[model samples]
Target chain A: MKLQRELQIVNRLGLHARACAKLVKTANQFESDIVLRQNEHQADAKSIMGLMMLAATQGTRLTVITSGADAEDAMTQVQHLINNRFEEDE
Target chain B: MLSLSGTGIGRGIAIGRAIVLDQGHNDIPCYRISATALSGEIERFNHAVDAVRADLKRVQRNLPTDAPPETSAFIDVHLLMLDDPVISQQPVQTIQEQQQNAEWALKSHADTLIDFFEDIADPYLRSKKNDVAQVVGRIMGELAHSPGKQPSDLATLGSSLAEQIIVARDLTPADTIMLRGRNMAAFVTSLGGPISHTAILARSLGLPAIVGLHDVIDTIHNNDLLIVDAATGTVLVAPDEPLLAQFRELQQQHLRHQQRLTLLKSEKAVTQDGEAITLLANIELPEDIEGLRSAGAAGVGLYRTEFLFMNRPKPPSEDEQYQAYCHVLRRVEGPVTIRTLDLGADKQVDGGRPDRETTATSALGLRAIRLCLSEPSLFKPQLRAILRAAVHGDAQIMIPMLSSLRELEQSLALVGEVCAELEREAVAFNPKVPLGGMIEVPAAAVSADLFARKLDFLSIGTNDLIQYTLAIDRVDDSVNYLYDPLHPSVLRLIRTVIRAGHEADIPVSMCGEMAGDPAFTRLLLGLGLRHFSMEPSQLLEIRQQVRQSTLAGLSGQVTDILNCVETGSLYDLVDQLNQTDSD
Candidate 1:
């Protein structure tokens, strides 16, 4: 199964280093091939370096694409992280 | 012998071997690594990363368990980032693919990451790039450091290097404090402003330090004989046999002079003609009162209360300020003239923000009394604090940078209002606390009699007075050549203020650099200035001159010297005046 969901970056600092690390660390937990697409730019969701290279900031909309088994679960977890602002009050 | 010039912090001389310390972030040397050497380079890189991790872990362990969560969390973030492939793995890949050395590869990736961060629109994100680079730089520093030679701090040095002069790129306060027990001969930094914590720490420690050398770290090697003459901010890398002998003799002479000063500390600052001079200390902080008992100071003439209000988030509460003033007053036996908040004019209370502009009208800006009067809420607490502390010990109020009687009157009104409130609340305070005004402005100095009649006493802060009067910023090295303490016009002003204060039946004290200087001790004594307030370090030496000179003897000559017009003749006469006391 494959799942694709578009989400807006709600964290005040957006996908900065700290947030990117948390996002990548969370995505690395699943067996799904996860990629985050911002505008025309795309990054492997499990790679901190790749996610940071995306340079996503607050109000930036990102498309999350996940494939293989548990792809739906991967999308859900990522959506949760983004919605919680990576659990960062900032 | 080799000579290097830098900004000197204190006046002292030292002779020692140089210990070139690789402090803070140092640029790493870069070179190519052969394919055959790639594995070894990788191993070296891994070793450095491990070393950095271990160092951080040690620091983490040293932190108290009850330490702020943010501090531990900060360390945790760095530790997690170390494990991140971006910092640890990317550099290794660069080393292998580029066939470059570990240090260079690490820096290259770090720079790329930092640059990526810089492109981020958010300022907060951009600032985090420094943290990433610094963590990477730590590994780079470890790899670049020569084997068996760790960066030196006073704590790390063995007794053998006790006489070694500290040569560093820069220092943190923690690094400086750990330098005790080394009998540190001297300190020379490649970077620091005069008011930087490093320079101020060196001054307080009474260490010979020359800062802002630009390249002292690279030029001077470890164990090279170093001759540091802080009086001139000159660092001679190595001296010839004859020059070495000369420096050794000068070292002894410096020691002897120090001993003489210490011996003179017990003596009263009384002139040969039986006229007594009040020698008081001009302190900036409570910490500066460490050795007031043996400093031969009657009391603190100027407790610059600005330190409490500066580098802080907001104006200190009345009680917070009261405790700080009380801390100093209760420690000292004599009266402490607390100068109410002299902030602004280089010292701003923006919670330690970087300065934006000095080109703006800095010296003439709304600072000191002007700033206080503009914000009564800010001014009221400080006044109340001084009043409250006066109940504990001999405390007096001194306002700074007053140009007119209106400023004085307004300040008095605030103090009066605070006292009334304290009375209404039945809070104990000395309502009779002697209120004085600092005469640093030309206008105030000229109108000394009017201010004298209204105030209890007057202190001539010649440092600012001279700076303002001659239109020369005293701290500006370029224009400071015009900052002559012995200028005829300056002396005439000093004489005028002292005479004005006397005629008005008030005592005038000088609490500037000129007051403590032995060169002007007799000259000021002759001018009929009664009280002398200077740095605690300078009080004894000034007292030594006071006990030796006859004020009655020098008054006649001082009058003629004051009347001299020619600059050359005036300098000659002033030099002669100093000679008479020495003779």
Candidate 2:
């Protein structure tokens, strides 16, 4: 079973390199095939290189799709991270 | 002679022989290898990778745990990528299939990755090229069995180039970090910007460097006599003896000036008319006290307590703070003004990882007293510690960035409350510990009299005062040129603040970089500033300047110079004053 949720970026600095590292770290916590997408660009949430290609900016919405036994858990954590704005820019 | 212009790192100069460092990896030779040597080549590659990994791990271990996590993350990402099929496994497969040498195989994979990163749309991601290049450089370095140049060639010239200047096309941050321990005279690169990582590291290491000189590597050769005048961004190559001799004289004068300063370490910072000015030292770390004592300091004027709050998991407990304060108070017989935890933006207390690059607005952000006052829990523990330390000796409490009378009143009231708490706990402490505020902000300087009337003493923190007054970011290299202490407005403000303190019957002291500089010692004296606290390294030089100056009519001359300022021409007066004194 695959679970997916779309959320809008809220941090002041957006999905820059630091935020990408943070996203990658959180996504790797679960045993799920995670993919993040913005417009036509899609990246493996586990890869720093893949996420860098997404180039998601503030106000841009990203879809988080995970397919594995822990898909729901990965979705919850990544959504929580996105909602909190990466703890950047107050 | 050849001339080149570039972005200068700092205002420093160096004259030395040139040593070209061809750190660029584009020139590495690549060739097909025999099947018999394939496994040996692969083995060599693995050994090199392990060595580089060990080096990177050591760097990670050396970094302070509390350092901004990104710093460690930077190396960690590279380490992780090293295990990736793209970096670690791809090149090995390429070596077996293509019959290519290990160096060439690695380069082939790196080139493909570099092209991919370059094609990334975001400029931020595009900068990842440097990281890839650095990682590849290390691997190449391993294959070549040397870091900067081929080892076989370096064996002869390395010793000869020990006292040489490095001229390179460009330098990555990792390359500089790797070579930071080398005692090179200076660095002249063909590329950099003022606030770039390269420039920041150069400034921190106090290395004279100039960058962005197009074709610098092309124009200069090995062993060429190069004059790196970083102050002016001018590189003189094989200059005539007359010019070389002039620079040599200046260098000797610089050395002699240092000798003269050391001689003044034991002398009194007294005026010709016999007025004994109290010259103190500003200390940060506990070890600074040793130098302070050796320099014959009268006392510690500003004991910044920020060190206790930095690079830690949480804020120091009151007892921990008290112990550190007691250590300093025990060493100094003279009074030590313990400035409370100047926290908030620049200095983190909430365990936030330190950022590699300081944001432009951190100076104006909630930092120093602003951070402490807003977070009373942070402020109270430090206040309690300082109060407790007072029982050991003459320890005074000082508040930083007190912009308004209300802030000062609130801080003092808090101090009073802490003292009462100590009393209630039956703790022995100096209840009447002297309280003062740092007059750093322009508003504080303008309202100096109001503060002087209430506080025991006034200390002018000119570093921030100048920046705040001029609205210039001193750390920002572009506008930092305008951070002039001699600006007419700045001089007048210092004069007004000093005058206000005197009228209110308070002793005024200045603790800033300007206070330590020998050039401004006479001007500060002329402005009636009798108290000064500076770095231990500068204490002797300032003392020497103070001893040579006569108070008689000095104020009149300084006043005349202050009036002569016609916007940015204040340096002329400084030159004129120094010229007359030398004559």
Candidate 3:
């Protein structure tokens, strides 16, 4: 299952590599497997290395894909994570 | 002696010999080590690790009690990486399997660790990789000890480079602390900004530093003497005598200005005719309260609540917020005005709802008061915390991004409700907590009279006011030129707000980037704004400017400038005012 979520890069320095990895890591915590696609490129949601290599800057559009029995829940969690910039404490 | 010019972040002049402190031999080499010779390398690596661990413990013991947590954490991570089985054992195994030298194995391992950290993406955690590399480098250097080369000797080498050293790359907190009090004349780095630890350390130490030099290393030779003017971010490479003489004069002038600033620290911010204008400081962190007290700030005009919201996963708890506020109140004898989080649509808090319609044009939308109303859960706790802390200090709560009377009423009702709940619980708090509103939006400014009647005071947040009034995002470099505070609209709005505040017999202040600037000090003073809150750095200059000008005279000149259509004339007027005492 694929869902579109709009996230603004609110961090003053923008969404650099580390922030992307965090999003991916948080997305991977759910049972469903996740894939994040930015613009035309897509990468594994579980692989922090793959997510950062995409270099999604702050204020970029990202689409998350989840597959498994809990795909909907995974998508919701990922969407919520992106909405909050993966939580400030992280 | 050669001099180079670059942006100056910190202030001070020093004459010293040139020293270059580079993160040497840390970069991973392409060549892989063969499987043979691995056991000896592993043994060497372990020995180095043990040595580094001991050194870290020593440093930790000696660290200052007030040192920033980041500094201590860096050393802690160094110890962790040294102890991590994944880091310690894997590299040794790889070196043995690949038959590679110690440097190759260390670099390869460091590369892997960097990759791991880079993938994590959190700034704090990502920065930790530097600590990892530093540890690994120490281990490698120990193993490859070119007879007589010691890790301790790096300090001596650093001191040697400190004299006339043009730091071409970013310096970590450790590097900065090590270089303190050395013959280090100035620091020029390829990375970092005014907020970086290195920059802050340089400021405290009175060292001249220029950051964001971008390839400044390639511009100068190893021994090429350079003069760094950190005040202007200019590095002079082999400067001629005339330029040197001019810089020396500028340095003297700066020193004189600093001395005058020091004198003003003890003096009241009274005008020539004996009008005492309260000079305050705007603080973002609780740590900054010390500087404010030292600077003799009458009070805190603005304590930005956004710092608590930013870069965190969850909103700071009510207890966390109270402690932070109470801490500031205890440190300063003056009233503290805490602005309820001024986060706009752009600054989204972690776990907070995102404003879907917000865009480049959405800065004015769903920010401050709007966000508070939309997310009452987030806003209520903060309101309760600020009010609770008010009993402990002269705390006043100021709402941000308020454009309507309705928003003010809603916020006031909420605060009233919180106060009642506290009363019912027998919680100690000042029931009559002075509530204020920021006149940042044009609507707020225009309706300042109404707000002044309802609110206790008004703080004009010029950064957002200018942005919203001009219809240009200050962050947008393309339209940055349009973000002029001197624009007719902004000035007119400011005049209106000041008038309204005065009419209601309520105090008004400008707590924005413009407030600290000496260039606009007289103009704001003339506009009937007696209260000024700015960064501590600008307090002295602004106070000095205030001392030199009479409110009546400055007001007349400002009115004249405001009425003039010549855009260039406004600057001319300011320039004239700046040079008035001199002439």
State the local distance difference test value for candidate 1: 0.78
For model 3, residues A1-90, the per-residue Cα lDDT tens digits are: 545555455554344444554565566577777877777877676654455445565666777678887888887777776667656543
Tens-digit lDDT track of model 1 for B1-583: 5799988866788888888675546546455666876887788888888999998999898998788866755665576678778888988999899987677788888888888888977777667777687788788678765342234444446764467788887765445545634567888887765544456556545678988787545667566688998879889976888887887888788878888789877777778878888998877766678755677689988887766655446667888888898899889988899988776665555522224234243778878899789877778888888898898999989999999999999988898999999999999999999999999999999888889999988999887888788887533445645767777778888988999899988878998778866778888988998899876767767788888888766889899888887877987887888787464
DockQ of 1: 0.18
lDDT of 2 by residue, B1-583 (tens): 8777787765557889887665544476455555876776677778778888998999999998679967987786667556545667778888788877678899988898788778867676577767778888888877776322221232224443456887776664435544544667788876655444455446534566887676554567556688877768888887888998887776677657667667777777887679998998888768778879888999999998766665556667889889999999999979898887666543444432243225333768777787677778878888888888888889877788889998888888888888889889998788888888888899999988888899988889887888899997644545645767888888988999999989988788898777877778888888999999876766776777777777777788798878984754567766665545531
Backbone clashes for every candidate come to 0, 2, 42
Q: What are the TM-scores, per candidate, against the unseen true structure? A: 0.66, 0.60, 0.58
Runs in model 1 deviating more than 4 A are A1-90, B6-11, B15-205, B209-225, B238-249, B351-361, B581-583
Task: State the DockQ of every prediction.
Answer: 0.18, 0.13, 0.02
lDDT of 2 at B41: 67
Kindly list the interface RMSD, in angstroms, of each predicted candidate in the order they appear: 2.8, 2.7, 8.3
Greater lDDT among 1 and 2 belongs to: 1
In model 1, the Cα lDDT at residue B7 comes to: 80
Candidate 2 achieves a global lDDT of 0.75
Q: Would you list the C-alpha lDDT of every candidate in the order shown?
A: 0.78, 0.75, 0.70
Candidate 3 local distance difference test against the native: 0.70
Q: Give one digit per residue, the lDDT tens place, for model 1 in A1-90.
A: 999998999989877777777787788789999999987889888766677677777998989999989998999999999999988877
How do the residues B1-583 of candidate 3 rate in per-residue lDDT, one tens digit apiece?
4344444665665443344444653343223332443454567667777777887899999999899865765465455546655557776776677765556666777787678767755574455466566777787666644321111233445445445654546665445545645655677766654444456556544567876665554455334456677656777666677876877787788789687678889888887767888899887666667678677888899887876765556778889989988888877787899999766554555534444334343676767888888888888889889888888889999888889999999998898888888889898888887888998888888888999999999999887788889887543434644667788789999999999988999989888767876778878888888999987666776788778777657777888778879988877877886666531
lDDT at B514, model 1: 84
Using TM-score as the measure, name the better of candidate 1 and candidate 3: 1
